[model samples]
Target chain A: MSDDIGQKKGLTRRGFLKSAGGVAAVAGMAAGGVAVGARDGLAAAGSMPKKWDQGYDVVVIGTGFAGLAAAIEAKNAGASVVVIDKMPVHGGNSIINGGDFCAPGTRLQKAAGVQDSPDLMYKDMMKAGLYLNNPELARILADNAGGALEWCEDYVGAKFTRLNFHGGHSVKRANQTVNASGSELVNKMLAKAKGLGVEVKTRTKMERMIANKDGRVVGVEVKTGYRYPDEKTGKTAYIKAGKAVILTSGGFSNDITLRQIQDPRLTEKFGSTNQPGATGEALLAACMAGAMDVQMDWIQLGPWTSPDEKGFGHVPLFCERLVGYGPMIDPATGKRFFKETGNRKERADAIILIGHPVIIMGDSYAVPKQVFPRALEKGLENGAIKKFDSLEALAKNYNIPLEAFQKEISRWNSFVEKKKDDDFGCMIFPEARPTVTPPFYAARLWPKVHHTMGGLVIDKNAQVFGFNLKPLKGLYAAGEVTGGIHGAVRLGGVAMADCIVFGRIAGKNAAKETAWG
Target chain B: MTRKHGNIRFSPGWLFAAALAFGVLLVYIGTPYAAPKQVASAKAGDCAACHGQEKVFSPSHPDTKAMSYKDCLGCHAKGGPQMLQGKLPGSHLHQLRGVTCEKCHGKVAKPEAVEEKLCRTCHNAEKLVEKTAKVKPENPHTSPHYGTSLDCTLCHRQHAKSENYCNQCHKFNFVVP
Candidate 1:
């Protein structure tokens, strides 16, 4: 949920839980139009906006990691910025995430002495992404990733806590947020904007891009009327630009049609981690103006993101942080998908469908809280797992699977059975033991799109492209909008890195151009 | 079966292909090999006159009244409220760029006086979906869309944003990019 707009969901226990920036996103779209004095001028004169205001050197669309990064960097660069959102809330999914997850050069990485290099990082990621990435973007991503993490810690006030997800990569890149998940990062960005004299406009929807005769961007027409200030009247107005437009909109994971089109099987089965504002407006506009789209076919696979509900699609994943470190058991095949390979696309896709027999079992507090009770009853009733008064009884439930699970149990049972993963490589290891004592438990998990790899293409300079593969003048793109940066699939902590790295680049360069012809 | 256009049949099966075909048809339609139009629209005169009333920023300002079709930008720059909604510089969709309001809105002295049917008359091709794209789109009465007062260029990014909007413009994007 965006700090701009959030609501109390049923997860009130999760603390005044918020919708994923719905209101803030709407304001971004609406206010963006109003700020631009959008022709069709920002909701036809007096429209209600939550936080609408006008004028800026740059208009950064979307408020997730990319947009947030762009806004912060642009303001720091001395250009007035208006960070607009279609979601009523501003934080987006970045806020609801487990903060202290993983990243290199992170304090956690230094402490662990994992012994790594950016080249090694890039090589490993390329292996993970199957080498389907633009070399330049990948190198840049790996080289500066650590600094970006540091920027978050230093600028965004992200507190560093180390956790071993074992999902992807080496070293501990997932850094924990000292505050509430990643809201600290989002808040830090908002605070930075306030400091930089940037305009924060929400509830604005991007209506259209007004370009000049030479096809250079002149302004953007946005729709208003929800709840914002400093917007144009009902008549379309123009917010001329001195530089480029940066779109940081997130992927269309929640869009049903988009999901189906991207991958019918995944969308048909497991729901993706997309919020409502993950609509295609900004992305499509960039493409219509001639940006090339890349690698859209790949989907991020996460077994838990899909919950217990079963139709063609509707799954839930228990919170990763709350679940802690646990071994996911495949019930259908009665084996582990190795361990912590969920973050690796190949590793995830290879074993996810080996018959949905996966049950994540862990020590200490790995037993899932929200759905644990129901899952325990279901496991015993259906015989997917056997409930035992002791570990022996649990063993009988897995007689055929004992040989498989035994390895997992013994590996973590020792004080240092395996600090460095020999199988599926994960830098940090979970502290808990596999011994479930008297009470053994397990829960269901499903794999699906955790993120999107497809987006608009850009040159090394980050200029937006046309149909002929030529850069569109006065048009620049970055963040998730620029594909080929992450290879075919993304590394876990790479999203934040990509956002910061390219967002800074795009903003710096975009600011140099004049929007008006 | 309802006819797609004049002779083409409109059926659910061929609707998509028909839309694409029509989008291609829009590339070259009944016109004098229009690389450019002399009098793009009859209303160009009125738009240039009144656009200065709002926030005078149309690209064609000072020489707007005196210049030919090309020099309108001298007096009126591109931000005037009237000029923006009226699509002064042009529509993102090239076909609608140079055309005057009279071509689609009709040549009546007042825009409202023109029969809405005149818009539908040529715009009935919208059922095909692809043909609905226009450089100078008709009034919503002819092909209803949201945020009408706003320029389609301002918000509606031409490329597929993601697969989600395919539901809204199913014909435009059968495949999610």
Candidate 2:
């Protein structure tokens, strides 16, 4: 039964005949961790920040989880710390993220008698991230799953009541709360910061790092942020750092310019789910700080698409899926980009099958019932889609090829309705699968720039990697700003886990800094 | 400056002299009396009094709110708080909103009946104004945080210490408002 289960899960038939304890490791990785780049060791990117201002003990850049964690640590260790962020709020994307912690072999999961191990978790993560994630980070995440979970629950007030998500978890280790809101997580992190006497300043945009003669990172040059009315008068403040700098600003999922630079097709077609401030300035900053970069070509996508570019803004994955019905499609072809699957990851693989999408298709049945009507209404509402009683009428309404539409529907029916899709190898098809229904529908959506894979690479200690192949003296980075996490491709939920885990590490390391001068 | 007085004899000579002085003041700055307009005038004073600290949970906040820099610097020299009680009141807290005593406490001492009379003018209670603080509690500080006959400013740093200082050790069960 165990061997059969392994095969069913697509585990390699030949792996370590390790003990049941090792299953925890394998399962944990499988549950919610991705490991890539385990072969040849990573080389150094060779850039460093020198000390500058004398006022601060530790200066953190980017206000996401990484920056916050570092600042909290630095402050508690009897050093004055200043956290600088480009956004109006702290915790960057972490605050806006769904509270589904993908920790494997956690105390919570174990307490529930759920059998899980770090090895399995690692293996699963490697698979989900498609072997593009860093193996070291993936292993650590699996190992510390229990400790991280306990910290999240005890210190940071994460309710973690709900522990389920459809991302990269094999077991139910993704911790969410009752209300299932990101604000709940953000609010808790903020509260925990206060309990530890950490000073938080919002609207304080960090421009760059201040380095001394030796090029040691000293302070961050910040401007009086968004809420500060007189942004023009720009308060030029420099909070000193005695030990290190951590950056956690989010990725460039929404930056039209960055998206265009990375993937123009994605920018022009599929829209972003990130906030308005989803620019990749942090990427630029890290590069200027001497970090090597990669993975600019990769990005994450969701099934939810709209005729009007700004689709459902900032909806959580599952929340939107609840009402989001049907497959997305190309209004021109009335076909689909990939084998239509209910599973989003499989759907992603299908979308990227070709360098470009052949077609985008979906019906009212396949999409969430609530989402279906809403999407159709939005398209028709926005004049992007036309509604008709029949496929011929629909084709004529939108100037689509009537015969082509008929043929496409027949093909969809053959594979979908008649269950003859063995040729196309499409996944399960319910009533919503085929477009053969009386009134068929179609819309156009292309991929867009979803994320930047390049970030400030870090060691197991979460210390910034220098060009010299050693960890930078006192610099650390976490969150989207630090890459080598989701190696070649990033799974949907891995990004959030990276933010929390690495953010905590950056904070703990920065907390132990000494006033050098 | 206008003179504070019960009577002012409006003479043509006096009015002419005032006009001449005002004209000279304006010319010295190379501009007409622009009324110190919003375009150029620096809006200074109490930056924290209006903008309280913004928490991730809370809305926007003031930068220098803990120990009202305006209150302290209103009399002292200039600048935000450097150090008052060895420990600098850490970052700004939005939780400081509920209480009303810190505005005039800490670093400087003030009497209570004097404090009560001062308080009642804005929040006037006919019979309640005359009652003792210990006998009849009014504010958060009135709940034993202000012991017997002690100076109000002894522990409270209006713009320095957070109003939720007592909350340091106490777990507050927030009934979601």
Instruction: List the candidate 1 regions with Cα displacement exceeding 4 Å.
Output: A1-55, A100-103, A106-108, A155-158, A161-166, A226-239, A309-343, A347-358, A362-437, A515-517, B1-177
Go through the candidates in order and give each one's DockQ: 0.01, 0.01
Off by over 4 Å in 2: A1-54, A106-114, A165-172, A226-233, A258-270, A307-328, A342-398, A418-420, A429-444, B1-177
Supply the global lDDT for candidate 2: 0.52
Local accuracy of candidate 2 as per-residue lDDT tens digits, B62-120:
33334444344443432225322223232121122232333323223441223423443
Q: What class would a CAPRI assessor give candidate 1's docking?
A: incorrect
- Per-residue lDDT tens digits for candidate 1, residues A207-264, read 6555554556644656553322223212233454557678777776655676678776
**Candidate 2 interface CA RMSD, Å:** 35.6
Q: Lowest-lDDT window of 10 residues in candidate 2 chain A?
A: A37-46
lDDT of the candidates, in the order given = 0.54, 0.52
Question: C-alpha displacement of A304 in model 2, angstroms?
Answer: 3.8
lDDT, residue A330, candidate 1:
60
Model 1 shows how many backbone clashes? 120
